[model samples]
Target: MKIQSASALFRVAGMAALLGLTVGCAPQTQLLSSSSVDRPITLGLSAADFEQAAAAATQSMLESGAVERNDGKKHIMVVSSVLNDTMQRIDTDQLVKKIRVELLRSGKVMVTTAIGLNGAEDQMNTAFSELSQSRKVDRSTLVKQKLAAPNMSLSGKILQRNNRVDGNKELVEYYFQMTLSDLQNGLAVWEGEEQISKLGSAKGTSW
Candidate 1:
């Protein structure tokens, strides 16, 4: 009985040591800082870049007094096309979403997702309209009641420029440019641009 118990104890200890070794050998996955972190020397756009650019653009727009509502009502805004003129494939919404969220939180602007340059972001509104029309519901009660024209429209473009610094290095620049236009007057109320540059190796592609 004593010998059997000793063998079992040895087996348990070996198993525990093996588990410890396995855990220790495993690579530790860590979370990096979202707001600011050391970026790789690559020309690709990152989440940090999008966030910073959006923040800067929104800040400029808000501080310029261009987003102010005169009648003490939240200004209805529509998002127009944000042209991506860069070589890399990126969604413009990654940057626009941040600005939209901030503006909405300020209670000064309401971004209408129901209408956009590409089309309606939410098709439910259109679907509902069709349903109401088909059912012969009161048009004044549903359509006119919910219909609101945007007072302002926001449009922008993202551009990229790449320059060869040397045989080993390259300089890449990205420009985030935005304009807030008055829908009624076709005037640009606010314009802002944010540029980000990175110096990196010229080996791999920036996309």
Candidate 2:
């Protein structure tokens, strides 16, 4: 067997190091969280918490059979007034989006972005409606195409409760409450609440 020279060995090592660095420093593709991974518990609402809450709410709604439309078709759902009662500043869509996605997949409901608490979810749709009016489009044709009113509305609130466990520890409870209401009858058909609690040091703020 022939032995390699020190200079040649050093050059090979340098090339290997460079290759390792290049691979290690390469940007990794980001992806949505999977169920197998353990989610971190923190002071504010987290992605995992939102996901769990959404899952629970959706499951409850589906099981209750309240999402069934009188027309014998998929219920048109309007997301409305998901009030944020907690101290944390969070877009309610973080939770609603998951529920909407799951509900759509189940083929039981369809969320209308054309209507919402804060006007329409799609500003372009609203703008197009205005343009049609300005252009003097036929009223009956515009009404048929531009107006699909929702049969049901989904609304809710997020509440937070805190209690001191000891001198250094505290227990925080978060409640995710959701309701599905019949717009025509003005009654809540389905309601669900999921609570998630966390114990952490009281030294820092959770909001």
Candidate 3:
């Protein structure tokens, strides 16, 4: 029998590893703490980062009395663009969704799925309204409704910075900046920034 060359052996081992991955030994999902402290560190942006920031930012806004009104009615809010300025691909909605939920639950603000920066967030609103106008549908069954215009707009940006801490370690910093503005006056009502930083091996990649 002839012995395989070094490259051939490596190729066989790689193929075996790939086959093993396709069959089993996959990673199991583990639940993580949403709290900012006592959590595992990662190179890229994480769910914990968004959750913590959203909770804190929402609480701060609630305490600022920006959403309060004399009429005892909740403020209507529309979500705007959330720019991601990090090196890694990320879904900015994770942060916004948490904040939206919190604000809605607080009973101080209501998020409109009928209006958005681009268009309606829920297309069902458009479809249902169009169906109501159709002659095929009974007019008595359809109730005339008016869509509420948003009084406030929310926008934000997520930014990242990296620097070498030492010969063997590097530091990465993330900044989440958000602003709430009044649609009528076009003035900022509330603004908040949350920063998270971590130190890791210099060879690590954030992206």
- Most lDDT-accurate candidate: 3
Candidates' C-alpha lDDT: 0.88, 0.87, 0.90
TM-scores, each model vs. reference: 0.79, 0.76, 0.83
- Give per-residue CA lDDT, model 1, range 1-207, as digits (tens): 999999999999999999999999999987776546555445799988998899999899899999886889988999998999999989999999999999998889998868876677898867776766565776657644386779999999999998988788888899999999999999999999999998888886778
Backbone clash numbers for all candidates listed = 0, 0, 0
| Alpha carbon deviation, residue 5, candidate 1 (Å) | 26
Candidate 3 overall lDDT versus native: 0.90
Worst 10 residues of 2 by lDDT: 138-147
Candidate 3 lDDT, tens digit per residue, 1-207?
Answer: 135587788899999999998778767777766565767778788888888889889999999999999998989999999999999899999999999999989988999999887779998878888987689998788877689999999999999999998688889999999999999999999999999897889898988
Cα lDDT for residue 124, candidate 2: 77
Tell me how far the alpha carbon of residue 37 in candidate 1 is from the true structure, in angstroms, after superposition.
Answer: 2.2
User: After superposition, which runs of candidate 1 have C-alpha atoms over 4 Å from their true positions?
Assistant: 1-30, 38-41, 133-145
Find the 10 residues in a row with the least total lDDT in model 3: 1-10
Model 2 lDDT per residue over 67-171, tens place: 766776888899988999998899998999999999999998888888877898988777776756565766556553456799999999999998898688988
The true-versus-predicted C-alpha distance at residue 190 of model 2, in Å, is 0.4
Could you give the candidate ranking by TM-score, starting with the highest? Answer: 3, 1, 2
The TM-score of predicted model 3 comes to 0.83
